[model samples]
Structure formats: C-alpha cells, structure tokens
Target: MAIFDDEPRKKARPHEIGQDLSLLSVDELS
Candidate 1:
C-alpha cells in the first residue's frame, strides 16, 4: 500500500533521485 505511493514519487524524478540513490548505496556499502 505505502510502497505504491513511493514508487511514483521516485519515478517522477528518476534521473536526479536515481543518481542520489546510487551514490548513497555505494557509500553505504563502501
């Protein structure tokens, strides 16, 4: 239910948001 709402919000700004997420993921892993 809540997941559905979050999906569109991300898809709405995928390019910018996606890049940030990728960086965060890498930093967290590193």
Candidate 2:
C-alpha cells in the first residue's frame, strides 16, 4: 500500500492503472 501511495506522488498521471502495475512489479521483485 505504501508503494501505491508513494508512486502517485512521483508519477501523477495514470494512477488509475499505474498503481496496479506498480504493485505487480513490486510483487515480482519481492
């Protein structure tokens, strides 16, 4: 959740879908 919250502050455009993508990427990395 922290990743999703922090991502929007930096990306700030496609938060709708981008948050999911970011979560996936973090999951894969983890």
Candidate 3:
C-alpha cells in the first residue's frame, strides 16, 4: 500500500527510462 501510495500507481512504459538522457550531452551530466 505504501509503495502504491508513494509511487504514481502505474508501471513504467517501455523506452521511458532513457528518453531524458538521450536529450542530454555528456557535458551537461558532468
């Protein structure tokens, strides 16, 4: 219950994790 309450209550869709990383260059990360 706590996990669901804290989280968005939805499973992560495919290809969702790295989308933001793709937008960033190496310099921005460092």
TM-score of each: 0.36, 0.36, 0.24
lDDT of 3: 0.41
Candidate 3: segments with Cα more than 4 A from true spot:
9-30
For model 3, residues 1-30, the per-residue Cα lDDT tens digits are 879643542333223345555534442343
For each of the candidates, the C-alpha root-mean-square deviation to the true structure, in angstroms, is 5.9, 6.8, 7.8
In model 2, what are the clashing residue pairs, if there are any? none
| Per-residue accuracy of model 1 over 1-30 as CA lDDT, tens digit each | 879866855665555455797765554454
lDDT winner, 1 or 3: 1
Worst 10 residues of 2 by lDDT: 8-17
Ranking by TM-score: 1, 2, 3
Clashes of each: 0, 0, 0
At residue 29, candidate 2 shows an lDDT of 54
Candidate 2 C-alpha error for residue 7, in Å: 28
Model 3: worst 10 consecutive residues (lDDT sum): 8-17
